[model samples]
Target: MNQAIANLASEADRAEALQLQLEAGETIVELDPKVIHGSFVKDRLDGFTDPKFIELREGLKTSEQIIPVLVRPHPDIKGEYQLAFGHRRVEALRQLGRKVKAIVRNLSDEDLILAQGKENTDRADLSFIEKALFALRLDQQGVRRQVIMDALTITSKGVLSGMISLASSLPTELIEAIGSAPSIGRPRWETFAQLLADPSHESTWRELIRQEQFHALSSDARFERTLKSVAVRKEKVSDEQIIKTGEGRKIATAQSSKRAVKLTIPTKHTGEFAQFLLRKLPDIYEEFAASAANTTSDNE
Candidate 1:
């Protein structure tokens, strides 16, 4: 049993013991949060407004940090360390005005993401959208797909693509504005992605999120309401309708809109009919003006 434990990998060996040691086999040490900088910050936070995060700070206040966070010397700044993972711990400690016990290492960008991803696996804590967005950010940083696959534990390119799609469904700024909806899962987030395909939905989101009422709701409720608004809007528009003549020939395509009527006349057998309508435009305008003038006179 003792030999088997010793043979286990460093990560899985004895996290308690392993976490107590740095990658260089040194013991964990305390560092000031102010001097610590964020590198590959894992959590997409909006001002650390999470109740759970506050819980973390409270927990740490009463106890020792069970998991040692990883940090490295600041690549540019002298005498400062940059955090690779465990951003929340750093943040909470930063707020508490305390030093964090961190494992110092010289980690590359790849090493940082891998370390963060491994820690994530141990916790399995990030929400689906968060993970997807993290994956997307790694891609944006020019990390290799296979390296991402290994770090994310993604099994297939297909799954990776799907996550990327979900992450990119909304603009980054928009998602940040709404905050991370922890209660939101993958299915609903995927639905939200589809809702954003409409340009109007993208435009309307800017308005909806600006409302005080929108901010009053819980994160999950905000996500639900925003997605539902888009869904209802899509339901209202029939999108397109076809008009067929008695002979079963296609006459026109009707597009539904909230404030306008749009019709498309095909150029096949309908070309002559379309020309005839163009010829009547002047008369059509005259009749429309006369009808409007009479209505104005009647109102007076």
Candidate 2:
């Protein structure tokens, strides 16, 4: 049994190695970075300023590029090529104004995505959300489920469906705003998705992320803050209560929630009652404040 397992593992290793092996007459050659374009379905969210990307760029400046990126002859453009994998390497080389070492092949769209996804799986650098978004983009382009599964190395249809659903639940603008929360996994993302089910909460999240202070935070911090903000908002609001008189007659309705309180009196004397309440509000508030201070002192 152990021998059989070893043989199977050996075959799997060989198969993976074969993917990077050169075909009959294929050879690695230097190509201008400008001529190599990104894949149709993006799999990464890290930008040029991302620390890891910057580290990659700095590392490339000191050592030779050991692996060649894969590219295919552009189907639409005559001389250009499209990148199947090694986007980060290509970007680093582009920034350095150096030629990219690549293996050019004639790959169809499906073939390209498969290669791209395989590289991502092997590297395992893509965050859960990035993979989810990548799967969503592939699905959006009408790629077959099997192809997406193979590309992402997903074994179960249920897992793939959940990923797509999670990505679809979020707004693209919101996701981009938060960036790729690398440390965040499915559970937190699912929790955030649940919070967003309320349309008002979704709106609040959108508006909160738009603020300058929110944008200043790191991607993971932004996600954490947003989740906490939404949760706090959820906790602050409670069911509206009916304000009644001593005899249990409903006189008004009061609704209170985070930062605001509203009172409604349905009687015809609403205007006069409102004026009377307005006149008494200062005294009522003063009395409440005095009581609150006394409670605090007693607690102390």
Candidate 3:
């Protein structure tokens, strides 16, 4: 961060430093164990103090099994390091009481941007909801949507919107719970968030989740049916009646009538067209009610 120290750094290092600052902003750069800065050594520190930083460090420690530390030299800032990528890994290393082994590459300005972009993108630990929030923040920070799309390898704004929308539906506790789980992938997380959005249906959804029924409805057909069933139940309607009416609504006459009288028939019905029609008929139309025409037709 010092001007004189920055002046001493190589042009490549300076450029890299500038780029990193531009992309991710300034922070305390951990010194390379091999190349000491001032009095700092590789295993000099105990652990990070900031709770958020500590959490990030713990996540990194857990993620070390996947990827190791990646670093790029900051040409402008001497005694300062540019994290090319592996932020989580670096945090993990710092947490684990180990020195970060860096590549020490002399990166150009463009390279630094690419590295930050790639690193932020490739090693993101956000859940579906978190990604949406992160992307939304980036969008507000003057980062182009296309740039975010490119960085995240996502094609449509719908995907981002869906994540945000779904997350917006959940309670903070639910969001935190989902975010903490490393095993929950984007798709599952998104689904969970979406379901949680409708509070009336959450209990049923939770029951389904408890029973591990999602496994049985893995296919598209079953999944859609499950969603529809829950949706109907949430609406306080019989799922079977809803499904039946839905099918009928699609193909029924398709005509806009001048006047229509809708009546509720208190019965459960399904199957052939005749059977469905029979269920809707007046009580007098039943075989047992031959003598008295007790029920009046709505549109007679």
Q: Which of 1 and 3 is ahead in TM-score?
A: 1
Please write out the lDDT profile of model 1 over residues 135-250, one tens digit for every residue. 88888888988878887888999999888877877677667666677778788887788778777567678888888999877777777888888888777766678899899888
Query: Model 3, which residues run further than 4 Å from truth?
Result: 1-84, 103-130, 168-173, 180-191, 198-300
lDDT of 2 by residue, 1-300 (tens): 986687577647745564547645668899999899999888887566788889889989998876789999988889999999989999999998899989898898999999999888866678999999999999999999999999999999999999999999988788888889999999999999998877657778878977999978888998899899989887886766888889987778876886788788875746687788889999999999999999999999
Worst window of 10 by summed lDDT in candidate 1: 5-14
Ranking by TM-score: 2, 1, 3
Q: What's model 3's overall lDDT? A: 0.48
Worst 10 residues of 3 by lDDT: 37-46
1-300: candidate 3 lDDT, tens digit per residue: 675455445435645755675477444444544432211111111123424457666665655333333455545556666555545456556557767655455665345434555554443433344555545545555566666666556789888666556545555433332233433456765565565465556666556544445534323333344456565564553222222264454222221223533333334332365466666677636654654444444335
Write down the TM-score for model 2. 0.75
RMSD of each: 9.5, 8.3, 15.7
TM-score of 3: 0.36
Q: Report the number of the highest-lDDT candidate.
A: 2
Off by over 4 Å in 1: 1-24, 45-47, 238-300
Candidate 1 steric clashes: 0
Q: Which pairs clash inside model 3?
A: 12-75, 13-74, 13-75, 13-76, 14-75, 14-76
